[model samples]
Target: MTISWLYIGIFLVVSLGLPAVAIILAGILAPKKPSPEKSIIYECGVDTHGETWVQFKAQYYLIGLVFLIFDIETVFLYPWAVAFDRLGLFAVLEGLLFIGILTGGLVYAWKKGAFEWA
Candidate 1:
């Protein structure tokens, strides 16, 4: 048990130390050149126009989050589906329950006008 703990302690030290060392070395060795153009916000090789801090509609984020949630649901379900033949009836019922919960959430969001483009 102590040997196993020793291994874990070493692994933890290396994992945490490597990134810290890399970050410190990068800060020490990287170029320190500073200029007005570099300080200015640059993106897509185009000069920024108008207000960059414009507020977006909350509906856009809702749509994106809904899409992401469903996308992740597919990721989790795909493996379960691939192994469906070996799974028992209880597994099937549990999977259906998970899907039902997500579906109910979708219906709630729909009723709350989260899907509205306006």
Candidate 2:
């Protein structure tokens, strides 16, 4: 058991260390040149003008949150669907309950006008 934990610790260390080392190496090897063109804010291949910080509508964030919630629902559902045949009745009930909660959330969002295109 202790050896298993040691192996897990080493695995975690290496996993985390690899990304840190790569970022550090890239920083060291990369050029340090800076110019006016590089400093200017560019968007969609077009040069930006006027205020850089524009206030976005709350509706956009609400719609995005709803989309993200459903997207994660599919991630959770896929494994359950794959192992549907081997699962017992209780597992099926739990999955139904999970789906029910998400449905309730969707209905709530609909009532709150989160789906409105305006």
Candidate 3:
């Protein structure tokens, strides 16, 4: 029991210590040059000409999040579908429940105009 804890403690220390040591070494060894050009906003190796703090459409973010949520559903669904024969009635009902919840979310998002481009 104590040996298990010792191994865990050593693992945790090494995991944390490595990153901390790397960061400290980088800070000490890295260059400390500072200039106005360096401070300027860079985009794809091109100098930004205008306002950098432009606001984007919230609808774009909403649509993207909706897509991501539905995409992740396939990760959960694929295995369930593949093993449906072995899963029996309870698993079928559970899968249906998961789908029902997702459908409800889709309906809500649809009603809220999340699919709209404008």
What C-alpha lDDT, on a 0 to 100 scale, does residue 13 get in candidate 1? 100
Encode model 2's per-residue lDDT on 63-98: one tens digit a residue: 889999999996999999999999999999999999
Q: Provide the overall lDDT of each model, using Cα atoms, as 2-decimal numbers.
A: 0.92, 0.93, 0.92
- lDDT (Cα, tens digit) per residue for candidate 3, span 50-92: 7778998898889889999999996899999999889989889
lDDT at 58, model 2: 90
The collision pairs in model 3 are none
In candidate 1, what residue range of length 10 has the lowest lDDT sum? 39-48
Q: Say which candidate scores most in lDDT.
A: 2
Model 1 global lDDT (CA atoms, 0 to 1):
0.92
Comparing candidate 1 with candidate 3, which one achieves the higher TM-score? 1
TM-score of 3: 0.52
Residue 7 C-alpha lDDT in model 1? 100
Clashing pairs in 1: none
Superposition error at 64 for model 2 (Å): 1.5
Off by over 4 Å in 1: 1-49
- The residue-level lDDT of candidate 1 at 16 comes to 100
